[model samples]
Target: MRSHGGRVRAIITGEAHIHADKVAAITGCLVPFPNYPAHIPMQRVDYICVVDEIGDPAKIATGAAKPTTDQRKLLMAEYCTQVVANTPYFKDGLSYQTGVGGLTKPMGNLF
Candidate 1:
């Protein structure tokens, strides 16, 4: 978690053994947030899968723009939901690492 001024940012990352579509489906199943803007800090998730003879390696990467206070809540909800729904594959494959803010928070209030 990172904080800037009076706002706090948190990123939750995990993996799933399912396809990208399925992950997106799970995200839709979770919460509905508005479109992500282009200038926000990015949070990505990757899913890797392998099925016996049929190897289906897949990944799901999602990002949201710097959110408003309410939007931050939505993002947290979505992140938590995604992590819980795909617990079995959490520690496998690639790890999900997200950075908040612009590398490091600026010295003063950025309003």
Candidate 2:
């Protein structure tokens, strides 16, 4: 992560080792967000990949898994917000970036 003229930028990436090439391709396909106005410019991205994964509900769902405690969730959100607030890159004109997911959505709300 870095900031240039108040625009915060990040390149989020992940890697996985899988036995099946098709799975890898599928997984890569799912990594990128659909293009939208809020998306950072494509020029900022150094690289990208598209992959696929099994989406069967039975295979993905965990029955009776305990939910995260409200307190823990609050803490995580606060911690994420605080990290951004404390960073030098944060300022009156901060441009935040984060993964599009449950925790990150809350963090963005806090920001």
Candidate 3:
């Protein structure tokens, strides 16, 4: 079970649906607050990828690290291609670096 900003989540690895069942059972049993009803809204969530193995990260020695000549050339070529594709819009005087930043307020502060 997990909670994201007051909304609870329950994940099931196997076929056991025990806790959800309990939540369903207790939703209606409130002796003190009979007028105030309890509700448990369920939603199915899914993960896109399941990565099993990861290669060891390449370690860099103490220095100003730079990509190899071949790597730099390849990356530069890709960047140039993207820039060329966007050149038409740039010619119309559109600045590229607009609306590219982190959230103005952290998610926790929003609620």
Candidate 4:
């Protein structure tokens, strides 16, 4: 954002994110609040807005992370469980991530 000359950010303090923290820290990108003092040396932010609400993150994530209910997919999860459990690679301390997929989360549940 700094290399782009300036960037605009709409902030809702209730859902502050780590990426925003890094940007604010590195470039002091925040605009001063209505009654607060300026807190930047070189402002990379063209505009900063404080909004009341974005959405309920928990509700959004719950909807997005929902697993598959299809019978075929559920059977696939069962097959995956059987196959993986029989494999040498499925030993203790096996590490995996359940990222961005409906099937993946259900597969994890089976094991």
lDDT of each: 0.35, 0.54, 0.35, 0.60
lDDT of 3 by residue, 1-111 (tens): 344422322334443344443322222223453333323233321212324434322433112332333555455545654665566554654333312112211111221
Worst 10 residues of 4 by lDDT: 1-10
Q: TM-scores for all candidates? A: 0.19, 0.37, 0.18, 0.42
lDDT tens digits, residues 7-109, model 2?
3222222233223233212233333465555344655555445435446555433433222336777689889799878989888756667663446656766
Answer with 1 or 4, whichever has the higher lDDT: 4
Question: How many clashes show up in model 4?
Answer: 0
Question: Which prediction has more favorable TM-score, 3 or 4?
Answer: 4
For model 4, what is the error of residue 90's alpha carbon versus the real structure, in angstroms, after optimal superposition?
1.0
Candidate 3 error regions (>4 Å): 1-69, 89-111
10 residues in a row with least lDDT, candidate 2 = 5-14
Arrange candidates by TM-score, descending.
4, 2, 1, 3
Q: Could you tell me the TM-score of candidate 3?
A: 0.18
lDDT of 1 at 11: 22
Q: Model 2: residues >4 Å from true position, as ranges?
A: 1-69
Candidate 2 Cα lDDT to native: 0.54
lDDT of 4 by residue, 21-100 (tens): 32333222434555244344335444444455655556655665667788898898789788988998988767756664
Query: What TM-score does structure 1 among the candidates reach?
Result: 0.19
Comparing 1 and 3 on TM-score, the stronger one: 1
Maximum-lDDT candidate: 4
| Model 1 score (lDDT) | 0.35
